[model samples]
Target: MEQSNTTLPSETWANSSQSPAPMGAPYMAAAMLLFATFLVGLVGNGLYLWVLVMKMKRTVTTIWFLHLVSCSVLFTLLIPFFTVYILLGFHWVFGTGMCKVLSACTHLGMFSSAFLLALISLDRYTFTCHPIWSRRYRTMSWAQKLVAGVWLCSFALSVPYLVFQETSELESSRITCVDYYDTSRDQDRAETQAWRQHTHVVLFLVRFLLGFLLPFCIIAGCYSQMGLKMMEKGLARSGKPFKVMVAAVVSFFFGWLPYHLYYGLTLFKDLSKSLMGICQLICIAMFCFNVCFTPILYLFVGQTFHQVLRTSLFTLVKTAFYEDLDSDGVGPDSSGRIR
Candidate 1:
């Protein structure tokens, strides 16, 4: 519920080498949250990546999803540096080059994540609702082309961040990557403000529509029809693939809706500073939760749950008590008659 205050004093702070004021408790809390998020994301996404690469065979769906999870892993790798920066009161100890790279990577991850979800939803629609037509046109090669298109689009969308990001020394002398257009000293500050207002309005509309609203509508509609089809066909309990599909779609919404809502609210100029900060923190938390929860949902939401669990447990037991079986030349099968 934190709000952002956009008004800045006319005179820019002259001193550029001063240390930032200590953030004390809030900074510590942000750091802790980032650490916890990093650990969860690393473990969960790592396991998913391992399973996808080393265990599961390639399919059209799996190919796209593998890239999606790879992007999340790359994004989460930056959490520690971000945590340190936030804990140090927003100081950017890393150089300006790192600022651009980190900012671009973060934006790329976000844009790609949303677009992948949209792509998955579209694929589901094609496969389930129009299977014959999809089979004719949606070959593995087609999927690869679509994924490539998505990444290209995402990179293009993030180009503005590369241009806009700059490291500057703040009033307290700490360096930070400031993402705002400063025109307070211009005689046409009013025009500048108006231009900013228009830009924000357009950007918000595009982001909400392309990134959130349209994708959610497509996903929801596709899943609703899919669920209805399953029910009508009396396949609800027949171990249908649609059940797993439903769970994944639902998890995607639950994980991302909060973060997007928070992002939308930042467009309001009247929002308070404290509320903006809190909302920013909450959005970050929600994003991390999305990253951590997705692999679990993917792993457990289908008929593979029991099989995977059993296989994992069996492997653990074998590794634990049979460490010497290899070196001792023991053969369990040969001596099994003792049982």
Candidate 2:
């Protein structure tokens, strides 16, 4: 019962002393997926960043995209370390500092991405429902400040990872990175166990709420209203933008929901080990795929970005980030089209 439930599958091999190679098939696949995702996400998000920051004009839309890509790129950069960790049969040769740093980065990436998606959805809702307000307030300066606050919040939430992450040398002579949340180390056994369980439950609930559930609610609410507005205004003729929006929302929903659900269920005491392993492997696959696929998902599902991408690819990248504006500054941009 001393084992942290948050410990990943790498730390759950049951026999850490034995090299994981023999039973590392699923892990090996995850490592390979991470490697491939790292390559694609790095290049794709990197190029998108270059395009947004360097080639495109500075606007609120471009600003949002720039940071989104930054998050993706930052997360993608950490993929190699994870892949190496898995390749090494989950051994923590990277030391305690790296262990803490990696955990923080992982949480930071997830938090920022989730927050950004929610913000994006809110932006769409405001633009569609309150165009005058969005236009007057959604300046580049405002957007920049808002994004800074997001990063600050994300970092704040990630602080727990740095605090709890530790590299523990197992009895098997293998070192594993894990969440050592038992703060009452000097307390009685019952007290320590209670503290650890409390910490685990609190962390899991907080992460699930902020990282997935709350954001999802915001997204669903915003998009639902937007859809109603579009339908009422007879603006659903094209179907392309609506389709893209639906696709993006659905993708985001499915992408992280199951991972959260699986981990949340793991909190229950009765779940069997075999079930946990299967769920863990599936979650890991989804996690890896999402890190690589998110930016591309936005790129392809965004009608504006997709159209520009179709025209001449990189040559037209600059146009993709441009907001659709009219002389009155309340044009298609007000419709909350993903630019």
Candidate 3:
């Protein structure tokens, strides 16, 4: 998913200014996978977002979840750009302007989704661990502010990528869009290339920290603490909402971690050139699978597998939005049903 910046010899299509990549099974697989994922992700996220937005009542959890699903939906909408490029055998027919916009959008979607997931985790943690504190501060208005902050940060970071994207034609009569850090054709700009590479490294590190490592750590920590508290307090039994949260968090980590790894290994040239191509397909497939499964996982989690299997898709979706998550905004009472 992050292979847009690798520097390779002309034969490999790594140098966008040189030659297009040769047709191969890897490219074919990428195109097919992206197309399939695009369809699934679009339908799943769109339905889930609509339900959350139009049917559910305003609550802290619902607001954060709505933002998370919205980000995934936006990400899936951009999948056709990659799908078309792969099917065209790495020829970027999209103009330079679109090249920059799409590239920036991809980065924005990726980073924003991670940020929102972190926000959701933090909310879950605070609400579960310190119910009294959350009851006071976890308002829908506050959730909206956090959502805005995440998007603003995502946009700020993505601007640098827009400035760095460049498009050029190859000897094989194809145009390609690539990050400007590829120094293969810029030997004369040795100093400039050095600076760009340095910037790329710094940006990659920051992205890794913010997008994958830090967010996952917070999520893990939050869930871990919640688990300990649940057990310690004799609440060993899991609720429907807890089950859904686990599914969402687990799926999210598995989906995003591989993409980050692909970026690292490719950016550092740690893997062989041939191996990197395989990794690219794997990463893209994983990322797409992640986007496709997230909404479905959330929807299904509110019910049993047997329940989902027995019902029609339309019925199942309608039922998912009606789940109010009684523990979300309620405090304990004399009956002691609230968390």
Candidate 4:
């Protein structure tokens, strides 16, 4: 799932660049999660987008929610492209530009989501703990500016990846979009390999640092401080908002932790192929679920959605938990009879 891993050792990057992970549960999980997440995530994110845009007015909170759901919606819309690619055995017939755009959008959405979520958490903390300052300073215009800055930074972070990704024709003639990492330079293997190693370490650190570690810490810290402040002020007695915040923070952390771990450990590939393979499945599934389901988990965990019917467990979960995910029972093979 990690297209460009610059944290890998030079030797590993050179030797394992073309090697796919051992196919088993992780590979299958990726396929299943792709389909399932797309199905559910699309509906959930779409409904949320509609609600945030059409039903709600512009505010600081709405601005944050707008960007958060926007990231999820963009990721969900791209699912069909990836689902097709996976079903076609991962050969990217989508061409080089499509590949770049796809990867760019994904990375951008991911970065934006993480950053926006952190900003939202911080906003909540300030609104709760420092109400005076929040009332005085928090404005939709300011939030909009912040959101713009986040998008710009996300785009910048993802551009290198977009540039590096290309369609590679394997010796077996199977073409897949992958990061070539400029290993194609006229320089000898040693020079290119050295470059690969250097760039990988830098990229790995940058991606891991900005994309996950730093954001996670900030979100966790903001919520923790907010929770403590609310508890002192007796507002934490409600418990529901705390639960939603917990869900948000936990979902973000768990969703992408495996992804970071996989790439981080890929720097040392000889550790255990089987273990890494299994980790991939967990990572991909959770990550996919996060992109689509976190909004439901966070936004609806505190609210009650009216259940339209008693259907399967999936439908029941979607119904009682969040109508946004159901979209009237749109499954692989289903009647549009959610009612």
Winning model by lDDT: 3
Global fold similarity of model 1 (TM-score):
0.77
Candidate 2's residue-wise lDDT over 66-154, tens digit each? 77667767777877766777787767688888877777777777778778778877877888878788878877787889899999998
* Candidate 3: Cα lDDT at 105: 75
Please list the residue runs of candidate 2 whose C-alpha ends up more than 4 Å from where it truly belongs after superposition. Answer: 1-22, 181-188, 237-248, 302-310, 327-339
> RMSDs, each prediction?
9.4, 5.1, 4.7, 7.9
Residues 1-339, model 1: lDDT tens digits: 011100000001111111134666755775687688789879877776776576544566567667877776876687776677767676778887776666667666656766777787677666656768876887778889989998898788666556655676755677766544421234666877787656555644665576567777877777777667668777543232344445555655665566556556656657775675665555556666666666566555543556666656323222211211222122123543111
For each of the candidates, give the backbone clash count.
Answer: 8, 0, 0, 3
Candidate 3 lDDT score relative to the true structure: 0.68
Question: Which residue ranges in model 3 land beyond 4 Å of their true spot?
Answer: 1-20, 183-186, 312-315, 318-339
Clashes of 4: 3
Residues 1-339 of candidate 3: C-alpha lDDT, one tens digit per residue: 223201110112333422237668767876787788889988898988877777556667667777777778877887787777767777778788887777777777777877887787788788778979988998778888989999999899778767777676766677777766753464457787778778768767987898779888988898889888888887753455566667777877877676667667645645566666666666666777778888788778757788778877765654543323444533333553332
Best by TM-score: 3
Winner of 2 and 4 under TM-score:
2
Worst 10 residues of 1 by lDDT: 1-10
In model 1, the runs with Cα more than 4 Å from the true position are 1-21, 182-188, 237-248, 302-309, 313-339
TM-scores for every candidate against the unseen true structure: 0.77, 0.83, 0.87, 0.79
The TM-score obtained by model 3 is 0.87
lDDT-based ranking: 3, 2, 4, 1
Kindly report which residue pairs in candidate 4 clash with one another: 6-200, 6-201, 7-200
Candidates' lDDT values, in order? 0.57, 0.64, 0.68, 0.63
In candidate 1, clashing pairs total 8
